[model samples]
Target: MSKQASAAIWLWLAVAVFVLDIATKQLAEMLLVYAQPVEILPVLNFTLLYNPGAAFSFLADQSGWQRWFFTAIKLAVSIMLIVWITRLPRTLLWLPAALALILGGALGNLFDRVLFGHVIDFISVHWQNAYFPAFNLADSAISIGAVMMVVDVIRETWHDWRQRR
Candidate 1:
């Protein structure tokens, strides 16, 4: 594809996300006490944590294999997203941006998994006696990206339906 037409141009977003995620994680590590909640609001806190497994601590109770298992998955997914982004049309905005976010988030967590054998999570949200799973900026990026993908699909489907009428 021509340089001007390559969707790879969106990769700058991925790099931005990665750098921001790493920087925030480092700050959290340096400033927050592990497993202790530093209240930011009535429903939000910064609680440093190390998640040794996938989202929601899946496979967390396992011996030690989950570390490398998740690492491999993250690495593979990052590569696939990069390739997909490259193949997309530059004119397509949302899809490429979403892919870049996911790619960046995956690499961010993969960095932690490879170096620390765990992913650092700090942001915490709770209400009364209930608590949501703690997550980091990387997770936020991935979730937002996934939501964007769903929104794009819905929009496209709606457009197609309208054209058939």
Candidate 2:
């Protein structure tokens, strides 16, 4: 059988995501005032914020070791994903796409953490007095990619069970 194309081709998607995330973050910073909300809807606003730690501001209050810690983790994860994507067959689209997204997002946030000492977050979601943690395009991409990966695993498991039945 002819060798199938490797999913490394999907790395382009990762590049696109990374570029877009960076562009949007820059634009948000330029257009939005820090900590000042620009309401776009009843539940959504653009409010510039910086995250020095991982999700939900975890370890943000620490003296500052978490930056390098998260940076190391992101580097490791991005490298592993690149290798895995290269080994996967292009016919397996969802998993590769998911990996690419995650790689892009990781790089985006890593760029911010290294250059600015924090991740730029501008998208705010709220319900009256309750507000969700501020996040950016990179965070959204990572979240979507993670959800896709979980769904793909569930699908594969179900397929395997059905095949055995």
Candidate 3:
């Protein structure tokens, strides 16, 4: 088997995400009370909530089994993302960063899920009566990374098309 080049440089960003996520969640837990929203801006609020399910509180109403189920899935996915990051080529730089961010975010929440049976979410946004689900730094990093990957895909597609012309 040939030796593979690792995309380890971007792993620091992942660590940062994990650390920040944990710290912020801890602060949110300590500072905010249940069901109370602290307005930070016109559209932003810090509202502490414990989600027992996946993104957007999916399966949150399940009969308590979803906690362990989600934990297992998060572990599997986080491992897979780490493997994917290491396998990524240097030229596809954004791919590794994106995968690493997703991995870190997943692990951050996985830590909570395994220990507390829930993920702490504090950030909230709303417009009039329309409200978005509260999320944390991990979720934000994952989302930004995903968008970066999408942009990378579009850039590559355009480059390939130009080359083929």
Please, what is the whole-model Cα lDDT of each candidate in the order they appear?
A: 0.94, 0.94, 0.88
Worst 10 residues of 3 by lDDT: 1-10
Deviation from native of the Cα of residue 140 in model 3, angstroms: 0.6
Candidate 2 lDDT over residue span 73-105, tens digit each: 999999999999999997899999999999999
Give me the displacement of residue 165 in model 3, in angstroms: 1.1
Evaluated at residue 10, the lDDT of candidate 1 is: 92
Off by over 4 Å in 3: 1-4
Question: What TM-score against the true fold does each predicted structure earn?
Answer: 0.97, 0.97, 0.93
Error of 3 at 67 (Å): 1.1
Query: Count of backbone clashes for each model?
Result: 0, 0, 0
Q: Which 10 successive residues of model 2 have the least lDDT summed?
A: 1-10
